[model samples]
Target: MSNEFALNAEARSDLGKGASRRLRRNANLVPAVIYGGDKAPQSISLLAKDLAKLLENEAAFSHVLSLNVAGANETVLIKALQRHPAKGYVLHADFQRVVAGQKLQAHVPLHFMNQETAAGVKTGGGEISHTLSEVEVSCLPKDLPEFIEVDMAKVEVGQIVHLSDLKLPKGVELVALAHGSDLAVANIHMPRVQAESEDTGTAAE
Candidate 1:
């Protein structure tokens, strides 16, 4: 994946809730902060519409961001985001500085491939249950993956794919498996209704 996420941000001098509210209402900007990596926390604001547009791409979350703050480009990653409770508009965002060769933890989305043709679903008439839609991984910035692929082609009914079952990209490591946890990532099982119907059929026979 190309590292091309760039946003234009303006440094903000104002502080407190009132200032943030004014920036949102009057300036139509989303308040944000940048911290970490030997730099003091800096308050900044970005165009609400622009930020929303940038977020439309799913890769923006895991890929490193190039934030142009007052003409200086800063390499950072999205740490957190706060949205309006009712309207779901972005209220604030947090960014953390990232340095080359330094390892960091990030949650990458999981992509289940070949689920429709999996042996469990095609032959066993089972449903695929995804226990985890995302996974946390530790890797350097260059080794970070936008998403992890979980192949389900050979999965059978009653079989579960755990954290250790996932094939990590080179240089990336699963945080859970590293700590000795083999949590389930996905599984195939018969639906409750189907199980009950089969039980009734067996009794009738």
Candidate 2:
């Protein structure tokens, strides 16, 4: 899947709780900063409402972003986001600048499709299970993907779809694999109650 979205940001000179509150109230802008790639951190502000709208899509959190900060533009990935706890509005965001030449670690969402129509789910008394929602992957900025598609059509009861089994984008690699944790992205399993009843009934016989 492909998406092209842009974030418009402005340079911000003032910082601190009071200054941020004033900026939010007066200008309706949210404070943010950009860092990474040997460049010093730059303080900036993004259009609050626009930023909120962009974030509504799950891809926005994973895909590389084109940020227009004042007159300078940068390709970056979202490193972290902070929000107003009570109001649930975005207060600040942290951007990790991406360099075209270097491989960067980006979080990629996992999209599982066609599981409901799977043969296993239809006749094997199986249910779809999600093990991993997102994964950290490394790739070049130009090779970035919004998400990785995991097909559950082949998944069967008692079977697991692991990280090693995922088909990654070209030049992309998963970081979670090195952690030695075999990440089960998804699985189709028989209903717990049904399995238990079968086991108990078989044991009694």
Candidate 3:
């Protein structure tokens, strides 16, 4: 998370579908835009190979990025990415300018640990089911976490983990919990096959 991701881009004066298509097909560049903050939105293009490489790392999605556009470096967050439906190639990207001390919403991935050693899974013969893989959090850029870890070692069978149960980093807050949702994040339960087998055994007895 401490590593900085930098992409070199160029200001694109040509606008429209035709222009973008030429940029991608001819120059091997992907169309992109930078907006938000006090500055007007700027159209730009990035190398397709370079962007694909950066996206190979999962942390890039949640990490702040430094975009160097024609010698000017700007701090931004990846807001949206558009890819080809069938080919799965990145077609366009949207970058949002971030300011210091301002709270922004970003989705951080969840990392579950100790599943095999959990009381429910080890002793109670239960399965761990993850209801959510990521959650939206509201925090300043500096306080943003790359991923939230949920320890399942103490979780018991039939127990559910909710948004309120998660331990948040300082200055970070779950948007759903703040909005009174308190949604379920994960749960430990008997597998369907085991449950069915137990029911059949009881009926036979």
Which lDDT value does model 2 have at 69? 76
| Candidates ranked, most accurate by TM-score first | 3, 1, 2
Candidate 1, 89-195: lDDT as tens digits: 99999999998889988888899999999999999999999999998899999998999999999999999999888888999999888999999999999988999
Cα lDDT computed for each candidate against the true fold: 0.92, 0.86, 0.92
Supply candidate 2's per-residue lDDT for 116: 86
Error of 3 at 52 (Å): 0.9
RMSD of every candidate to native, in Å, equals 1.8, 2.5, 1.6
lDDT of 1 at 102: 94
lDDT of 2 by residue, 46-76 (tens): 8898899989989888877889877677888
Q: Model 3's lDDT to the true fold? A: 0.92
lDDT, model 2, position 187: 85
lDDT string for model 3 (53-79, tens) is: 999977788888989999998788888
Preferred candidate (lDDT higher): 2 or 3? 3
- Error (Å) of candidate 3 at residue 123 is 0.7
